[model samples]
Target: MPAITVDDVLVLPRLPRLDPAATAYRPVRRLITAPSGYEGEGFPVRRAFAGVPMPELDPFIHLDQMGEVDYAPGEPKGTSWHPHRGFETVTYIIDGIFDHQDSNGGGGTITNGDTQWMTAGSGLLHIEAPPEHLVMSGGLFHGLQLWVNLPRVAKMSAPRYQDIRGKESALLTTPDGGALLRIIAGEIAGHRGPGSTHTPITITHVTVQPGAEVDLPWRADFNALVYVLGGKGTVGTERRPVHTGQLAVHGPGDALRFAADERQDSHTPQLDLYIMGGRPIREPLAHYGPFVMNTRDELIKAFEDYEAGRLGTVPAARVPHSHGQQPPR
Candidate 1:
């Protein structure tokens, strides 16, 4: 909720209104409520992309809404060392702190609306956890982790990392100054975010005030999706009702329409949304656990590589705790 914001939205650049007669607004194709689940040492999460067909979620495989949880002392949890290949992991923190370390010497502490992007293009070992002090004191934690797939041509690219601070996002407002848009990656209205991507995509976080609506221009060729992070709202021109933990997939169009309800719960003063879309890869996908590939043989090779320690060794510092903790296939 404390992600980048402004004292007065009217001061920011506003989205230009589009012609109603010419603008083709995307229609809501499906609405799904995410199922609750657990991940990485028992941290609570919501499976944001569950029950959706792969073609509809092209270039994106998994998404987890991590904790709106307030942990008691000693209750904090995190992932043990693990391996991933052929994809990217994007962790965005809205209200908490997280420390991350990968075998590639990419590790840091990010908190209060920061993001840690890890691209396990070929393969790598990584660990994510709370700092020791936070584990002892406990506090609020809320965030999201999204898995983005690389095209076949880039599947074997070298792993990389990008640390994006919340302030680096491009901030904009709706025409009436009733909503805020934070562009995290890709471009919107020609204003691009700080993230660099191998694929063409756009990821934005939207916060709408009560009774506010926004008609956003989108790429006609890219897929469109919106997921509710919290609060209540309606998506698309049909105004299909949506609330927290819901995801809406939209049909082809040149724009999207959504608005927050006039009344919101006390706990949620605004309608928070995570919107993303990308050009579909459309390539054959063979996936198993953390490895995503184009063929079953490629998947088998991935597993074999990991077991054979060709996926990179766990850092010497973590050998003590990461040994024998290989994630089950």
Candidate 2:
């Protein structure tokens, strides 16, 4: 654990310049617009892809873009006690403080740029909300949460949590210094993220300057997609334009190419992107609300155990910080 510095971001490896003519994959499939919805105690959210079920995004079930809204004093709200099984919940905080407490005695505060990777294997009860102080004097609340499915064999394992600091993530700038990528759970330009995963996944927070270019490579077998956080950009060779609050579902490709358009508003001279991909689980999912299992019978058993007090309760006490074990490099 040497000290991480800004120089670390500036001197990272550059993306490979693959031959455009020899490229094997670059197909923009469909675009998904996440409709607005409310979750928990009326917390605003936008449900991205997999709100229904697209097996192509297997190993990855759901994506929710939480508030980028300015919360008035006492207006902040969040999820109450809930149980999850058969998969992991990945929370990446962007603009506010999110507090968490779980039955396994796992809890922490996720502030700007921090990430909380929780494996809700077996079963566990947890609650997430704005920190009490923030709830009292409300500010901005914004982040993204993704559900990563586990294999049937690993679904019933004991639960665990990973609290990774913002600085722990690999922050990289493009060779021309026009694009920036914060790698939270995957590799980009030879820089690896801090968060560990049971499945093969890559989650990068990208920001590109107007007219700038950023290229990212991924395994051909992995399902790659991008969620536009702000501004606008063109993706892949198709040059399909995607704007804020839209999900670009990309087809099988060896790499991802994105650029912010120069002919955009001066108020928005940059584009923010959340690019993700992973090895598909390729298994049938019996999903119901918060529980995802291989069979309906197992799904029923989950509810039975939860109702029988098998899954623990949210703590009365606040555990401000519960650091998790680092995955081996």
For lDDT, the strongest prediction is 1
Clashing pairs in 2: none
lDDT of 2 by residue, 1-329 (tens): 01123444457545566667777655787788889887777777888884434666777888888877889998887776779989999888888888887899887888888888899999998778787788789898888898899999899999999998988888777767777777899776577998788888888888887898776777787888899877888988778888888888888778888899986666445788888888888887899988999999999999999889897776778533222322100
User: What lDDT is obtained when candidate 1 is compared to the true structure?
Assistant: 0.89
List the RMSD of every prediction in angstroms: 1.8, 5.7
lDDT of each: 0.89, 0.79
Which ranges in model 2 have alpha carbons more than 4 Å from their true place?
1-12, 50-53, 263-269, 318-329
TM-score of each: 0.96, 0.91
Candidate 1, residue 44: Cα displacement in angstroms equals 0.5
TM-score, predicted candidate 1 vs. hidden true structure: 0.96
* lDDT score for candidate 2 against the true structure: 0.79
